[model samples]
Target: MKALVYNAPYDVSIENVPDARIEQPNDALVQITTTNICGSDLHMYEGRTAVERGKILGHENMGIVEETGPGVTRVQPGDRVSVPFNIACGTCRNCLSGWTAFCLRVNPVEGMDGAAYGYANMGPYDGGQAELLRVPHADVNLLELPPGTEHESDFTMLSDIFPTGWHGTELAGQQAGDSVAVFGAGPVGLMAAHSAMLRGASRVFVVDKEADRLALAESIGATPVDFTQGDPVEQILEATGGRGADCGVEAVGYQAHDQSGQEHPELVLDNLVKAVRTTGGIGVVGVYVPEDPEAADEGARHGRVAFDYGTFFTKGQRMGTGQCPVLRYNRGLRDLVIAGRARPSFLVSHELGLDEAPDAYRHFDKRDEGWTKVLLHPGQ
Candidate 1:
């Protein structure tokens, strides 16, 4: 099998690896057709996380089930499915309550409640970036796609960013006719803007410095705010008639940067607090770890940011932050794709074979021009 393996900081390679096979009674073996290189993967690629070398580096995955364990009854060979990045056992208390991201039974680390494929500190599960992948708790974790579903590129997003983007809007309590200010125009942030528009937002403002990304956001009818030109908060406020947006979304996470391109761990949080109206809600879908040994400051190294909690409290604003539980939203989002209401593939800027994954990682990691998103087709 050929797969992308993390070698070191800013380095990854396509190397021959052992074939993935079902290791548990409830597992299924999937022949991966499409996988993605996520922005979160860049955290590990940049040496910001403690991910081990030789680990396969993909999480957004979808494919056809090649085989199933004896215990798997819901799906069988030849069935197409999308594997959520969060691997959950259906019997856990959190899973039963619709919080699959916090499932208590997946992570091997004691006291850790969540797990993700190819993610640092998540679990021992290998990702689906290769020709094959093993899916644990197959019946519960694999979303069976509609028969003959041909939108592989679009459906592939259901595994992570699509649902995650929808979750952001849901967390912000966005209502029809409301205005939303989303910080960051990365794939997830763009998806958040698309979700906001799909849900009837009166106005959507997407903030970022990249001209291409901002243009993509504007293509979807979102007002683009290039922070490099001026204060993003002021720009958003000006667009919102000075009342501030009805809601704000933080999609840039811990790697947020200021106008000068310096890493400011709390930049998005502070910007969201000031950009959202009083009593409005804020949803954060960005990845923020408890520790980043490569952080620019001692406080951020421990995952502590100097946020404006005093101002947030005074404004009576509410905030929701965490990983998105794909199970809670993937099905509905998938239907939206099936019905042609959404087209997430528009974010995919590059489609490469499995062999090109290493170079793709480097290009995407640099946030290079025309590299908004990269989708890897293992079967290509």
Candidate 2:
């Protein structure tokens, strides 16, 4: 099988690797149809994380089940399914309590509770950016898709960003008629804005400098705030009548920067603290690590940011931070797509084959024009 393998910093290529097979009794082998190259993957591709060489690197996946183990009862051969990024054991305490991202039985490394395919320090499971993928705990992990090829692009999002975007709103406690200000306009940020609209937010503000991404935000009825024009926090506040947004989301991870491309690890968090209303909730769906030896900030080398704890304390703001529990919302979001209510595929700007992944990574990492979202078809 040909899979996308990570070689070193700023490098990845398609290579003929060993075939993926069912290794567990509850596992299912899938013929992958669509696998995404996530912004998170750039972290590993750029050597920011501890991700080793020679590992397959994709997690956002959906495909048709080719075969299933004897222990798998619900999911079977020939069923189309979406695999969540998290590789969780269904019987764990965290999984039972709806926190599948923190499942205790997945990652074997000490002190790490959660696990994901092809992620840094997550687990040993390989990813689906190839012709085949082995899904563990198939009965509980795979979300069945309807028959036919309808909504293939949209349904593909159910594996991660759609639910993750919805999870950002869930963390911020967004409600109908309330105002939301989402920091950043990347895929996840755009999805967060879309999720805000889905939940009936009276006003949704997306902050970014990119014309293409902000245009996509506006296409979904969100007001675009161009940080390059002026102070993004002030723009959000002014748009909210100076009271600030009722809730806010941090979609840019620790790699956040300004117009001049200077890396500021704490920039988005501080901006969110100022953009959101006092006592209003804030959700952080962006990636933040415990260590970044390559970070530009001297204080952030140990993964500690210069957060605005003083104002956060005085404002009494509520905060929720972590990875999305993809299983919790995939079903409902899938129905929305089936009903023609949500179209996450709108954010997709490019769909290329697996061979083009390395170039796509370079363009996306540089935030090149018109490269908003990309979907890699392994079998193409």
Candidate 3:
């Protein structure tokens, strides 16, 4: 099977790997049709996480069930499904309560916080960036696509980014008629802004220094703010009549802002504090973590970065940050996609075969022009 393997920092390639077969009675073997090179994959690609070499690297996946274990009842062979990024056991206490990402029974070998396919924080599961994937707890984790949908590219994103965007909006308590500001104009950030609009935000301001991304944001009905030009906070405040926005979402993660114009997760927090009105809330969906000693910015011991707690405290604002619990919201989001209310596929700028994954990763990781989102069709 051809799979995308992490060779080293800034090095990924499509190599022939061993075939994936069902290893457990609850497992399902899926012939992966589509997958995406996610922002989270960049964490491992950049050597920011402890993702081991030779691991397949992709999480957002959708495909057809080639075979299923005897215990699998929810889906059978020939059924199309979109697997959530988080692998969960539906019968677990956490999963029963709708917290699938925190499932207690999923990653027994890695402790808690298990993930599917290829992922850094995820366990030893092989990702779907290959020709096929073995899905543990298949009955619990796979989402079957509806009968009439044809845009596989769009449905593939529902496996991760769309639901994640919805999670960010839900975390921020997005409501109709409220004005909102979202930092970062990347795929997730743009999706967050789009989600805000779908939830009825009166105004959605998307901030980023990239001209292409800002333009994409505008195409989706958001007011674009380029951080390189001037103070985004002032622009947001002025746009909102000096009271700031009703809510703000930080989507840049650790690739935030700093004095040197480098990666700083704290800048998003500062912008959220300054751009959000008093008592407003903020949702952060960007990836943030300690720097790797060997790859980039290795000096820091603590995962600590700069932040303006005083401003946040003074504004009396509420904030939420973490990984999106996709299982909790994917069902509802699926309905939205089925109803044509959310077109998250709009964020996808390129679609290529799994063989093109190395180049895709390079371009997307470098934040290259027109590389908003790249979906990989594994069998292509």
Candidate 4:
């Protein structure tokens, strides 16, 4: 099988690798039809996040079950399914409580908190960027697609980004008639704004420096705040008449910016704090790590970044952050997509075959040339 192999910093290429096989009794071997190249993958590709060389690197995936273990009962051969990015053991205490991302089982590299396929901080599980994927705990991990659905292309996002965005907005406590400011206009940011609207937000201001992404935000009924032009806090405050937004979702993670034109992950949260009204809540879905102490770039640093904690505490603002419990929210998001209430498919800007993954990595990692989201067709 040909899989995308991480060779070095800023280098990934398609290389022939062994075909995946079922290794556990509860596992199912999936013939991957569609997989995604996520922004998180870029963390590993750029050497920001630690991952072993030659490991396959894809997580947001949807495919067909080719075969299932005898213990599997929830799904069977030939069923279409979406695999959540987290590789969790279904029986763990955390898994039972709907926190699959922090499952006590399925270690990523080692220890607890389990692992993710083809992810930086995730365990040794191989990714689905290849022709096949071995899905452990198949019964609990696979979400069966609705019967008779044809356009599985868009629904593929249910594996991660869609549910993640929805979860972030939900954490922020967005409600009908409330205003929101989402920092970042990337795929997740756009999805967050879309989720905010689905919850009936009165007005959504999406702050981004990218013109194309901000335009997409406007097309989806969100007000685009170009962060490069001026202060995002001032923009949000002016837009909200000095009361600030009711909720602010920080989608940009640790690579945020401070007012002095310096890049810092904590800057994003600070701006969010400055933008939202007192007592408002914040939801963060962006990736921030406690790993990588010597990260050369500002975006790839550890969790100890500086932020305005004093201001946040003084404002009495609540905050939520971490990986999204995708399985907990996948069903409702799928219903939204099936009913046309939400269309995450609009985020896909480029579609390429597995062979084109190297170039895709470069464009997406650098965030160059209108590359918002890149989808890889594994069997193409």
Q: How well is each residue in 249-323 modelled by candidate 2, as lDDT tens digits? A: 999999999988899988999998998999999999999998888998777888889989899889989899999
Q: What is the C-alpha RMSD of each candidate to the true structure, in Å?
A: 0.9, 0.8, 2.0, 2.0
**Clashing residue pair totals per candidate (backbone < 3 A):** 0, 0, 2, 5
Candidate 2: Cα lDDT at 198:
95
Summarize candidate 1's per-residue lDDT along 220-248 as a digit string, tens digits. Answer: 89999998899999998888789999998
lDDT of each: 0.92, 0.92, 0.82, 0.86
Question: lDDT tens digits, residues 166-215, model 3?
Answer: 77777787789999898888878888988899999999999988899999
- Please report how far candidate 2 places residue 272 from its true position, in Å: 0.8
Model 1 residue 63 CA deviation (Å) reads 0.4
Residue 199 lDDT, candidate 2, scale 0-100: 98
List residue ranges in candidate 2 displaced over 4 A: none
**TM-score, cand. 4 vs. native:** 0.95
Worst 10 residues of 3 by lDDT: 292-301
lDDT of candidate 2 at residue 101, scale 0 to 100: 95
Instruction: Arrange candidates by TM-score, descending.
Output: 2, 1, 4, 3
Per-prediction TM-score to the true structure, in the order listed: 0.99, 0.99, 0.95, 0.95
Stretches > 4 Å off in candidate 4: 108-112, 147-149, 257-262, 294-302
TM-score of 3: 0.95
